[model samples]
Target: MGRSPAADAEFMMRDTTSHPPAYAPAYKTSVLRSPKNALISLQHSLSEVTAPVFRADELGPLDNDLIKNCAKDGLPVGERLLVHGHVRDQLGRPVKNALVEVWQANASGRYRHKKDQYIGALDPNFGGCGRVLTDENGYYFYRTIKPGPYPWRNRVNEWRPAHIHYAISGHGWVQRLITQMYFEGDPLIATCPILRSVPSEEQIRGLIALQDTSAFVQLDSRAYRFDIVLRGQRATLFENHVQGTPQ
Candidate 1:
C-alpha cells in the first residue's frame, strides 16, 4: 500500500542523503538571505530525508495551463506565449515525472500579490501561476502571457526585465531548484544585477530562453524554448542547486 498521508508529510519534512547539496556557493546573495543560513554548516551534507513522491492521481489536466482557468470569459489581455523545455540530470538523462511551477507578472507589469505596489491596472482574467509535470522524456510546456517589466526599490529607478519564475522538483525533494527564465533580445538582460551575479557567462546564458520564430503564428503570439539541465556535466555533485530569483 502507498504511504499514509501523514507519513508522507513526515518523509518530506525530514532530510535525505540521496538528494543533491542544498545551496550553491556562487549564489551567495540568495544563500546569505535565505532562511537556510541558520543551517549553513549542513547545507552541503547529504540529506537523511527525501521529498514526498507525488501520485499521478493528485495532478489534474488543467494544472499546466495558466490561461485556461481565466479564459472562461475570454483569453486574457496580452500576447499569448508558449514556453516549452526539457529537464535533464547531470548525466544528460531525462528527469521524468518532475513537477514544475511557474508564476509571473501580467503584461502590464503588475502582479496579483497585494504587496506589489506597481500602479498598473490588474487584469481580472489572469491569475499568473501554473504547474505541470514532466512527461516520460522529461519535457514540459505551458501557456502564458509575455510578462512586462516592473519597477522595484532595489535601486533608484530600477525595473526588472520580463521574466517568469520557475520552481522545479525532480523525483526527490532534495533535487528541487528555483530559478527565473528570461527572454532573449531583451536589453535589460545585460543590466540585470541578478543575472550578472552569476560567475560564469555560460551559466547565465542558459537562463535566457531563445525565441523560436517557427512556432510563431500570423497575427497570433510568439514562442520561446528554454531547456534546463538540472546540473552541468562537470559540476561537482550537488555543487549547483538553485539559482533563486531575487525578489
Candidate 2:
C-alpha cells in the first residue's frame, strides 16, 4: 500500500484557532452572520471522525478533464486556460494525492445549472466541472476556460469576480476545503463582498491566482497558477511549543 498522508501531515485533524470562523458575520449567507441564529451561538466541539481512503483505481478516465465531458463536437467556445498549482500543508510541506475539484461559469458568465438565470447563453460543450489528484510532489494541473464575471442580487449592478470554485479533499472529510479562486487582476474583486468577507487581508489575497503566460502549454491556451494551503493538525501545537502561548 502507498504511504498515508495522515501519517505525515495529520491533515484530517481539526484546529479551530487556525481556521476561519464557521460563521463570519460579514458574509451574508453564513449561518453565523446573524447573532440570533441559534446554531452559531451554541458551543461546538470537533468530533473524532475518519474517512475511507481512496485508491487511484477508483478514479475515472475523464475525471481530470472538465472540457472533454461537457464540450460538444468541437472545442468549447471560450479562452482556453491551463490551471495548475501545488497543494501544501500549513507547515509548507507538500500534500500528495489530494483530490481537487473545480467548477465555474462559461465564457459568457452562464452556468449549466437551471436556476442560474443569468440571461447568457450556456455553452453546450461546457458543463464546467473537473477533478484531478495531486501528484507525489503535490502538483495538480487541469485544462479549463476563463470564467467571466456575472451579476448577482446583492446590490444594484453587483457583479462577482471572475473565479472558479475549488473543492479540495485532503486525507479525510475534516480536511476538505471549499473556496473560490479569483483572477488576480479582476476588476470586480475589489467590490465583491464575498471576497472581502475573509477577516485577514492576507488570506483574502491568497485566493487570487496569477496569470502565467510562460506556463501555457497549448498554442491558444492561457495559464494560471494557484497554490492551496490546507491547515495541518500539528501546526498550532508546534508553534505553541516553540513560541510559548501568548499572555
Candidate 3:
C-alpha cells in the first residue's frame, strides 16, 4: 500500500534514461547506513560495495495472495505495479534468490507499527506490511491499498507521502535490503527523506503510474500493480510470508 511522490512533483515529470547515477553514490551511502545495514553504516565509503556476494535460485512462487496481502485493506487487491530493471548485483548485476519484503501505510497514511499511537484510528486487523521475493526476471509484484500521506516526527510540519518499504535477502547471508517505493504524483514527496535521498535531477518517471482499470486492478476489490527492481548479481526472487503485526 504505497504511492510515489513523483506522481505530483514537477521534477518527477521529466524523463531520464533510468534514474541518475550522480546521486547513486549518495544513495549507496544512505542505504548502507540505514538501520538495516548498520554494519556498513560507519564504513559507508568502504570498497565492499564491489565485493562479490553469494546468490540463490531455489525459491518457489507465492500462490496464496490472500495470506500475503493485508486482508484488513480488503480482498483481491489489483495488480497495478508495472516495473523493469537489470538483474545484477548491488554493483548493478544479476542477483539470484533475493528475498524482498515490503510494508507501507494504508490509504490513511498510518502504519501498524508499535510506534503508531493514533487512538480511535487503529485498524487492529490491518497491520501494514507485505513480503515477497524477486524473480530471475529481477522483477516483483504486490496488490495492496493505495498509500496515503502520513505525518512524521522529522519536522513540525513534516509528512511522509504514501510509500512502500522493501527488504531483500538472498544467499550468503548477504542480508536483505530495506528500501522503499514511492508512488508518483504525491504532493508531500518533495520533503520526504526517502525521496530526498535520490538525485533531484534524475527522471523518476517509471516510478509513477495512474490507476488503471484494464489491468484488472480495483482500489477496493482489485490489485494495484507494483513492481520492484533490485540491483544484484542475477535478478533473484523469493516467496511471501506472514510477518505483519500479530492479529
The lDDT leader among the candidates is 2
lDDT of each residue in 1-247, candidate 1, tens digit only: 2222222221122233323234544434455664564453333222322445565688777777777756667778888888998999766889787888899999999998998888977888898998888899999888899999987766677778999999987654446788999999889888776776665677778899999888776787688998876642222224354223222
What is residue 77's positional error in candidate 1, in angstroms?
Answer: 0.8
Report, for every candidate in turn, its global Cα lDDT versus the true structure: 0.73, 0.76, 0.46
Candidates sorted by lDDT, descending order? Answer: 2, 1, 3
Task: Find the 10 residues in a row with the least total lDDT in model 2.
Answer: 40-49
* Cα lDDT tens digits for candidate 3, 115-195: 876432544444556544556755555555555677755546677767777666543222234555666567776656556
- What is the overall TM-score of model 1 with all chains considered together? 0.75
Model 2, 97-165: lDDT tens digits are: 888889999999988998899988888888899888898888999988889888887666788888999
Pick by lDDT: 1 or 2, better one: 2
Model 2, CA-based lDDT: 0.76
Model with the higher lDDT, candidate 2 or 3: 2
Q: Cα deviation of 43 in candidate 3 (Å)?
A: 13
Off by over 4 Å in 1: 1-49, 217-219, 231-247
Model 3: number of backbone collisions: 42
Q: Which stretches of candidate 2 lie over 4 Å from their true place?
A: 1-27, 31-49, 235-247
